[model samples]
Target: MYESFFGLAREPFSVAPDPRFLYLSKQHRDALGYLNYGLRRAGGFVLLTGEIGAGKTTVWRAFLEQLPPRLDVAYVVNPKMSVQALLKRLCESLQVELPADADRPGAEADLIDALHGHLLLAHAQGRRTLVVVDEAQALALPVLEQLRLLTNLVTNEDKLVQVLLIGQPELRQLLEHPEMAPVAQRIVARFHLQTLSRDETEAYLVHRLTVAGLTGPLPFEDEAIRRIHRLCRGTPRRINVLCDRAMTLAAERGQLRVDRALVDQAASQVFDLPGLRRVGPGQAARWVAGGAAAVLAVFALTRLLPPWQTAGATVAAASTPSTASAPSSPSAPVSAVPASALAATAVPPSPSAGKHVASAASPASPPPVTASAAPLPHGLQPYDSQAEAGDTLASQVFGQHLPESEAWTRLARRWNPAFTPTADPCAELPRQGLRCHSSQGGLGPVRLLDRPGWLLLTGPDGRSTRVLLEGLQGDQARLSLANGRTLTVPLLKIAPWWQGEFHTLWRSPPAYAGDGVLAADGASGTWLAQQLARLDGGPAQDGAEGLALRIRAFQMAQGLRPDGLPGPLTLMRLNHATGVSEPTLAGSAAAR
Candidate 1:
């Protein structure tokens, strides 16, 4: 349904095991290598294992597509079968003639002799034979031993038959059983496939999109992709289900792009996230964000505290009346009472989570994190060179130190060089059909948004400095000063000074009139009805109650609060998702 709308030749995230859309991540590539090695080595048993929905079958199919010449193959998928049935199936797969009474009892000798005769003939012709068992973990002991016996159908120099066993992780553990010692001795090659990493997950998504005829920019926003990883945990099948649902929902809402809120909404509906799906989308986003921030703050603060400080603070706080109250002693540890923790109980701090984490993790005597004073000599480690290089690149290239405000000017020019800013850049930009968005998060949020923004840095002495973030390359960031000097610094190097604030520009939808609640009246209401029709597939609903219900449904699916009145965040997401021609870090509009 969404293929034409999203400009996709076909659905990109189908869960089917199609080798055509196979993405070879590092571990997946390694898994295929092991399979090929086993084929060449002609081992008695080759083992491949991974979690369910880990794309094992895809890799297996990809490997099976290319087989060497003179190789006869028999494949079995269903594992729940008797040893006699399995043997008969194998003979049938190999095209060996079976007796009319092959199904009769006590015909085991006939089946084995027939298989051996065929194998001997194939071996005489310098051919090899392979038996592949899918879901081999369920194979009974006798059935497994029989396969081992088949491997015994051998010549002096070469084994005539090879068996490959593929299943979930249990198959690997099954081989370690004391009872399966003979089978263990014959495993010449083995590999366990693992889930993709965050980087690999991004690559996997893009690769699949590119293969699905997506030549435009990615349909998934960076944050949406990040959320997909968190929800799916790198499982290929889970990613497929989540992405497909999100796109369909976006398409129905006339959205061309998928964002974090859309992903959360899709996950709430499709996946089994308790409490998330039952509530309004906005509340669920808050719930998830709240929980993550609380956990992150506690963990970050605990890491920054010394053991003695942590223990003292805990004891003192317990001795005090309430966690909300201040300590009696002036010398009490600052951590003795957590003011934010109590406030967070009533209101979640999801938007400011990065700020909280940065503050909590900051040391009391926050050390200076500025780069080296002078350039390092040659032959030092790469990090040292990079650290010193950032300063050098900043100094000699951009010799003048411009205040942070100048970063905004540099950022603005990137979108339009001839554009002149009014008194209030943020306010003025909106009038020009552009917008200024400020967010508090680590480099991750910036990278996800895929925009060049200015970051506010708090110096060791508690001074605020601003630097222009021009671009990012892998782990290195390209930061600029006032006069266009740019330096490449590892992202980690600058993490110490950055306080989670990022300022960037985005294009606004036509006649946006700024951020506010959009009601069920006037031009906004007419527009809302038009947009909702795509999803609701019904006549326009203009009455407050009727329109409110449709609006609420859209909000819930987008993971908004479902206030039944759309606002800036809600409308901006609609613009991005529905193809309003905004600039992105990914370059082009796959959504359009």
Candidate 2:
């Protein structure tokens, strides 16, 4: 309903786990890495455990996206089946033929044979095979044991199949059972998926919105984002639900932006807080009567006390002088108090004596004691000012230079966890204190002095170089080079003051300078050329001998045969040292 008003192409906050809408946070990336490692390292089981709606399936989809075409993949979405049935399902997924009357053992054998054949075929074609089982926690022990046994199928060099098991945290506990230890021991890689951080939640929202065709700033306010973070605790599924409800509420009310009130309302409705429900007039009267009785009882008790004690009661009552007046008669109108006022006055203050009341009423007296600071909700750590400063520095760097590259944006995402970018990187990296100058020099070394502080240099050739320096001002800084060109540095690239762990780290080699040192003798003599290339400047002689020396050194460092014949590895290493990728050789049998 609100889509047209906001100019959105579609609802941006659906709870469904659409693969197209998958956003890989840091935790998601780590989980995917574990999955990839497990499958690539054959002869073992890889386990991925996470809480429900933690995006395990999304990571699985991402894994499938990056899989090479040559590899055959079998995915088991449902794992609640008998051993025989499970084997049959695997066969069906792999498209293997089975006999019409095949029983348990028969089906198992046929499936194994088909898998073996496929593995051999894939190997011959320079490929691999992987089997992914989702919700493996539901698999019975017997079925899990069978999975362990399947890892036995292997050649002398490598395993014929790789297995990935993905499920909830219960899966991990299940694997700890004595009966499942054998299977657990076979796991080569494992990662537990976790919820996103507060900043990550914000980024996730913008990413989804942008993907859904949102063109403006995020509809949610900062407080709304924080509220969603608190409510969902960074779980992608919960965040989606909350955001969806908030958007719906905003649209219904004809609001362009979803504010904190809308978010709180949605949360209260969805979570069903009893206190938030409104009471009718009859209920309200009863509540007010009960409150009045309690107050009168306290007042009667105070009246019976000595004058000195009663003075405290009187003072307390005076401190909270009510603007409400008593009804003149039984037929007089009853004043209706606002809910906000009632909420504010629901709790009574402790009684104090007349002396305290006089002090409070004095013109120069201080205000009543109030809470100095609100405690952060559970599970939240206090914000680190240093980290925030560092992020500010890094944001400035990218804001000024390399604004168009996705890699740069990813860097910014890492540096400032709070920034959420849609499709356009332009709006994300604000241009503050950003200045750029073109230089004639090649890419210069990037140094991080402090977070949000950076100095980037680009050579006369227009190739850029990045360095992050600590203690920079604003989100951008400018440096003038010798050739009358200026370089722009974004603050996001700035390194934190404490990140300098290695003051003596080796410098990156100068480009193309290592190309001229090679020796002619071959594998036995390449090491000498490497040492010569490491020397300060170019060799005294710029002849064929000098070039041969550099080549020998490059070949030796790269572990090549080093015949000094300029082989692929030798040229490749030399190119890498010079910051270039060697082109593939054409018409060469070895290259082919």
Local accuracy by lDDT, each model: 0.69, 0.55
Model 1 pairs whose backbones collide: 217-590, 255-577, 256-577, 256-578, 257-577, 281-559, 282-560, 282-561
RMSD of 1: 22.8
Local lDDT at 321 for model 1: 53
TM-score for each model: 0.53, 0.55
- lDDT tens digits by residue: candidate 2, 1-592: 5667677787677766676677755466456545644554556898888888889887788667656466777788889988778777777777767556557454776666766776677677777667889999999998898888777777778777778899999999999999998888898888998888876787788678877877555688766888789878888888888888888888888888888778878877776666446557876676567557546755784668774455445445423433342222222111232112222332322222222333344353333332111222222221221124445432332334433334334334333445455565433344321111111211111211112222343433444534332222222333322222333343222222122221101111222222333233343234334433443133434445555544443333343334545532343344334433211111001100
The runs of at least 3 residues in candidate 2 whose Cα sits more than 4 Å from the true structure, single-residue gaps closed, are 103-106, 268-592
Candidate 1 on 395-469: residue-level lDDT in tens?
333344556446666677667676675555665566666677787755445654566778776555565557777
Go through the candidates in order and give the C-alpha RMSD of each one to the true structure: 22.8, 16.1
